[model samples]
Target: MSELSMGDALKLFLQKSRLKGSMQAMQITDIWAELMGKTIARYTDKIQILNRTLFIATSVAPLKNELLFQKEKIIQRVNEALGENLITEIVIR
Candidate 1:
């Protein structure tokens, strides 16, 4: 009924496809690295997404504590980076 521009069309396609969730999940790591910086990245053992939650495994206790304090901020930053609200909660271990 209506024509969509290439950029808008592709965005709609991605949204409608069922691949959007997977794509968003993959983008989390890269976005974390860019936003959190290398210092945090260096200590991060693993990052995972499960049921809209982010699970982080870290080697440093202090870093883990610090990240916990910034959990809400990190969620906001990650969503801002993806331009969508994908992460609901962050679990640091």
Candidate 2:
């Protein structure tokens, strides 16, 4: 077997672990502002990932409606940021 670097080993472990979703959620949260802009990120209440679905929570009605229209763009941006097609669906709440 070939040797794996520490970073690669950790990535492998994460890919096979139950914490992957949580980790991905954290990554998204960390980049939320940069990925979606400060205004949107500020209004976003929560972010969660499960079963390849992204859940975005917000109390702002207008923002929610706006998000609904940008679902496809959001998915594309997020997937690009993550360097993988990790999110296949989005739920705006």
- Top candidate on TM-score is 2
Candidate 1 local distance difference test against the native: 0.87
- Stretches of model 2 off by over 4 angstroms after superposition: none
- In Å, residue 35's CA in model 2 sits off its true spot by 0.6
TM-score of each: 0.83, 0.95
Candidate 1: worst 10 consecutive residues by lDDT? 23-32
Q: After superposition, how far is residue 71 of candidate 2 from its true place, in Å?
A: 0.3
Which residue pairs clash within candidate 2?
none
Q: Which candidate ranks first by lDDT, i.e. highest?
A: 2
TM-score of model 2 (CA atoms): 0.95
Q: Give a tens-digit lDDT track for model 2, residues 27-77.
A: 999999999999999999999999999999999999999999999999999
Could you give the C-alpha RMSD of every candidate to the true structure, in order shown?
1.6, 0.8
